[model samples]
Target: MLAPFLIMLREGLEAALIVGIIASYLRQTGRQAWLPAIWVGVFLAIALSLFAGAGLQMASAQFPQKAQELFEAVIALVAVAVLVGMVFWMRRAARSIRAELHASVDAALHGGAATWGLIGMVFLAVAREGLESVFFLLAIFQQSQDGAAPIGAALGVLVAIGAGWGIYAGALRLDLKRFFRWTGIFILFVAAGLFASAIKALHEAGLWNALLDPVYDLSGVLPESSPLGTVLGGLLGYRDAPSLGEFLGWAGFLAVTLPLFLRPSAPMTQAVGQK
Candidate 1:
């Protein structure tokens, strides 16, 4: 529940910020008439995302058990890759995103087909985030069996919508740099877990035969079914009895990725919607 919630919250918040920034830009520039196009793009992108997610889920249901496990592993790997790319991109782009969007808006408005240009701009922006969310949710849902995950994801989206509105309205002042930085770290952890799970899934699918030994067996003391274990498992891919391959995959991912993520970079001079 918590894992899905946080992931969705971050993804939704990103989309909201993007739409809000564009909307704010339009309103401020006396282009309020073009605002409806943004909504159109947003709704369309959302519909596509929903459709894609449903289609994938249905398709996976018909697969045989081993095939399904392999599918799950593939999805997890894709999610991890997407997530890692997103985190790093945002880290580098955060300071310049506001300027980039404004430039995009200008370019679209100046184009011969202004309406379609704006629509396409907004659609691509929102769809990128929406698709990212879809993959993350699919990976999370495949691992979780209870009813709480969906509810958590829904709540996260709602909260993100509200937050976006507040920020656009200037009713809230959030340190977006800090927010994204911490969440980026959190996402790295989640991606590491996903990578580990993907390894386990591959083994289950009879694809990988190496590292069959148990790295640690604490199933009796802290079983995955236990409340704490479940939470840990969902958040950090905690396995009470993780095989050697799983442990190495998880640790190796963080070992290589975390340092690069935390390394020093150029300073950010502006927020997402600065004038």
Candidate 2:
């Protein structure tokens, strides 16, 4: 639940920011006539995302038990990949996102009578974010056997949308850099858990046998059904008795991935003669 919520919040905020920038730019440039087209694009993108997610869910349900496990494993792996990429990509790109959006807006304005192209661009951009959210939510939902996860995810998204609106309306100011930084770190741990979960799924499907057996049993001492255990499990993929493969997979991912993320990017240097 926590994982899905945070993932959706971050993704939704990103899409909202993009759309807000485009809309603001058009208004400022006296091109507000195109506002309707932009909205049309947003609705289309959202519809497409819903369709794709429903399609995948239905298709997966049609598979046999073993095949479904394999499918879930594959989806989890893909979600991890996409999640990691999104974190790093945003880390590197966030600083310059405004400039990029401005350039895109400028290009759109220059391409006369290509209103549909602008719509397509917005659709593709928002849809990319939406599709990624869909894949990630599916993976998280699979891991969260209990039913609380969906509620958490919905809450996160609703709050994020409110935040986005606040920011746009100048009613709230967010330190986006810090927001992403903290969330990125949190997401890294989530990704590590997903990696472990993926391995467990694959093992369940009989696809991988290495380290197939449990290494230690902690359930008696700290049962996963307990409140603390449940929180830990939801936040960091805690298992009462993890297999050797799962332990190695989680530890290995954290050991390698966390450090690189912790490392600082280039310092934010300003021009010597700047105001």
Candidate 3:
């Protein structure tokens, strides 16, 4: 539940931030006529996400047990890839995103493209984020059994929307740089868990089973189904009794990914999204 919530919060906030930036730019440039098109793009992106999520969920249901496990493993891997890519892309783009968006909008409107071009630009921006959210949500949803997970995710999105609006209205201030950095770090850890979980799924599907032995057993002391266990499991990818392969995969992923993510980059000379 917590995992899905944070995932949606971060991803949804990113989409909201992009939408807000575009909308504000349009208003400032006296291009308010294109605002309706922006909304249209947002709606389409959301519709696409919903349809894709539903289609994938329904299609996966028909598979046999081993096939289902394999499918799950594949989905988790894809989600991780998308998540990691978005984090890096955003990190690199944060400083120039606004100017790049403004330039894109100008080109779209002036290149004999008009409203459709602007609409397409907005669509791509929001849709990319929307689809990423969809992938992560689907992967996490499959691993969850309780209803709270969905509720948490929905709430997270709602809050993200509110936060975006507040930022746009100048009623709130957020340190998005630090926010994104910390969240990126946290999410990489979560992705590490997913990496390990993917390996477990592959084993279940009879694809890989080298380190089948359990590293440790803690179920008697702290079952994965317990209240604390559930929260930890949702947030940190906790497993009461994990296999050796799972541990190594989890550790190896973090070992390689976290440092690269945390390494300092050249500081932005200009604040792109400042109020």
Candidate 4:
């Protein structure tokens, strides 16, 4: 549930920021008439995301048990890859996103049939974010069958919407750099857990048996089904008793990725709508 909550929060905040920025830019430029087109694009993108998620879930349900496990493992790996790419991309691109969006908006406004052009631009942008959210949510849902996860995701989105509104309204000032930096680290750890879980699932599917040795058994102390254990398992991919392969996969990913993610770098300029 924690994993789903954070995933939804990050993805939702990103989409909300994009939409808010577009709306703000249009209003400031006296292009308020274009707002409807952006809404249309956002709604359409959301619909497509939902459709895709449902389709994937239904397809997975029909598979045999072992096949389903394998599929889940594959999805987890894909989610980890996507999450890693997104965290780095967001950090690197934050400084220039506003300018990029404004440039695109300016071109679309000047283009012939501006409404369709604007709609296409927003649709593609929001849809990309939406699709990524759908994949991540699906992966977490497969791993943790906790009933509260969907509610957590919904709450995260609602909070993100409020945050975006406050920021756009000039009533709130977020330290976006710090927020993103910490969340990126949190996501890196979660992705590492996913990587480890994926390996475990593959073994469960009767595919990988090379590292069947038990690393250590903590199930005797804090079983995964215990209250705290469940939360930890759902959020951090905590395994009470992990095999050698799972331990190695988890540790190896964090050892390599965490340092690179936390490395100090030059400060970035704030993203502005125009010069």
Candidate 5:
């Protein structure tokens, strides 16, 4: 539940921030006429995301156990890739995102068929985030048995929407850099867990045979079904009797990605996601 909540929170907040930035830019530059089109793009993007998620879920349900495992592995791997890429991309783009966005808006409004161009821009931006969330949520749902995960995710989106509204209205002041930095670290851990889970899934699907032996058995002390174990499993991809491949995948991912993420970068010249 907590895992999905955080995942959605981060993803939803990113979309919200993008929308907020675009909306704020429009208002400042007397392009408020395009505001309604922005909302239209957001709605369409959301509908598409929901449709894609539902289609994938329903389609996966019909697969055989082995096929299902393979599918789950594929989705987990894709989620891990998207999550990692998003973190690094945002890290590198945060400093110039506003300026880039402003430039994009200018380009969109000046292009032929300006309304469609702006809507297309907004749609693409929000859809990227929405689709990313959908994949991440699907991976979470596949691993979880509890209903609270969905509820937590829904709540996270609501909170993120509220925050976005507040920020756009000038009623909220958030340090987006700090927020994303901590959440990016949390997300990397989640991705590492997913990578481990993907390895386990591949083994289950009869794809990978090596590293089948358990590295250690913690089931006697901390069964994966236990409440704490479930939380850890859902959030950090914990397993009681994890295989060598799983352990190595998890540790190796963190080992390589963490330092790269934490490395210092260029200084920001302006406040992020602020009007």
Candidate 6:
């Protein structure tokens, strides 16, 4: 439950931030006429995401046990790929996102593109984020054994929406750089866990075998059935006696990914006297 909550919260907040930035830019530049198109895009993206999640869920339900495991493995892998891509994409785009949006808007309006184009731009932007969230949520839901996960996810998203609104309305001030920095680090750990979970899924599917036996059994000391253990397992990919494959997958993923993500990008240098 906590895992789903945190993942959705982070992802939802990102989508909210993007929407807020675009909306605020339009208002500041007297392009408020296009605001309706933005909302239309957002709604459409959400609908598409819901449809995708439902479709995947229905399809998975028809599979046999091994097939279901395979499907889960595939989904988890997809989610990890999307999450990694998002982290890098946002990092690279952080400095130029505002300028890019402004340029795209100007081009659309000047090119005599219909409002549909404006709507499409917003739709695609938000939909990318929405679809990614859908995939992550689906992956998490597949692993969840309890009923609390869905409720927690819903609450997280609701909170994120409120936060987004507050930021956009000037009622809240978010340190976005700091927020992403901490969340990005935390997400690396989450991704590592997901990777390990994916390996477990593949093994269940009979696709891979643990080359090494369980490293050690800690379930007696830290039972996953316990609330604290469950939280740790969900959030940090904790396992009592993890197989060699799980350990290697988790460690390798974090070791390779975290360093690159942590490296600072070149500073944005604005022209002097420009606001």
- Indicate which candidate wins on TM-score: 1
Model 3 lDDT tens row, 4-76: 7888889989998888888888888898888998899899999998998899999999999999999999988
- lDDT of each residue in 71-98, candidate 2, tens digit only: 9999999888988898898988899888
lDDT of 5 by residue, 1-275 (tens): 88888888888889999999999999999989899999999999999999999999999999999999999999999999999999999999888898899999999999989999888999999999999998898997886776799999998999999999999999999999999999999999999998998998899999999987899999999998889988888767788998999999999999999999999996667667966
- Which whole-number lDDT from 0 to 100 does residue 25 have in model 1? 96
**Where is the poorest 10-residue window by lDDT in model 1?**
266-275
TM-score of each: 0.95, 0.93, 0.95, 0.94, 0.95, 0.94
lDDT of each: 0.91, 0.86, 0.86, 0.87, 0.91, 0.85
**Candidate 5 backbone clash number:** 0
Which ranges in model 3 have alpha carbons more than 4 Å from their true place?
A: 267-275
Over all chains combined, what TM-score does candidate 5 have? Answer: 0.95
Better of 2 and 3 by TM-score: 3
The residue-by-residue lDDT of candidate 4 on 1-275, one tens digit each, is: 67678778888888888888888999998989889999999999999999999999999999999999999999999899989998998888887899999999999989998999999989998898888888788888888767888998998888888988887777888888888888898888888888988998899899999887888899989988788887887666788898899989998998998888888766766678885
Model 1, range 1-275, lDDT digits (tens) per residue? 88888888899999999999999999999999999999999999999999999999999999999999999999999999999998999899888899999999999999999999999999999999999988888988887665688999999999999999998998988898889989988899899999998998899999999997999999999998888987888778788998999999999999999999999987756668868
- Candidate 2 lDDT at 19 equals 86
lDDT (C-alpha) at residue 51 in model 4: 100
Residue 109 lDDT in model 1?
Answer: 94
lDDT for model 3: 0.86
